[model samples]
Target: MHPHSPPWRKSPLRVWLSSGISSLFELLNAANELFSRPRNLSSPRTPR
Candidate 1:
């Protein structure tokens, strides 16, 4: 068997953990943008 074989690699748990962390950050950022501002058509910037 070779030293750099599949058996020497880390398990799937590590991959899942890293993916979850990154996804969580993306979700939080999207939520922050969604809640931090209000969309209004009656504002001065609106077109008549």
Candidate 2:
């Protein structure tokens, strides 16, 4: 049941890769949100 072997021995690899990719996307999206919007720490930095 080696990962680099035949497809029949890749079930764990498949699940691992899919979950890793999904979490990677979630992290990226969260970072994008953090930078793309301004948070109201104390005063709103909106335009005057």
Candidate 3:
């Protein structure tokens, strides 16, 4: 087997893993945004 074949074999796996990670991060970001808004709304940040 040639050296180039190893890289080709792993490229699909790398792409799959990276796409999954990106999707997970997006979900986490959305969840954080959703959960953070209510806390800010419920808490009054005005200094008495």
Error of 3 at 3 (Å): 4.4
List model 2 lDDT by residue over 1-48, tens digit each. Answer: 645777745688888989999999999999988766656532466565
Report residue 44 deviation for candidate 2 (angstroms).
Answer: 6.5
Model 2 lDDT, residue 24, Cα: 97
If candidate 3 were superposed on the true structure by all CA atoms, what would the RMSD be? 4.5
Q: Considering summed lDDT, which 10 consecutive residues are worst modelled in model 3? A: 1-10
Best by TM-score: 3
lDDT of 1 by residue, 1-48 (tens): 546657425868778888999999999999887766545434556775
Clashing pairs in 2: none
The alpha-carbon deviation from the true structure for residue 19 of candidate 2, after best TM-score superposition, in angstroms, is: 0.3
Q: In model 2, which runs have C-alpha deviations exceeding 4 angstroms? A: 1-10, 39-48
Order the candidates by TM-score, highest first.
3, 1, 2
* Tens digit per residue, CA lDDT, model 3, 1-48: 545666755798889989999999999999999999878876776453
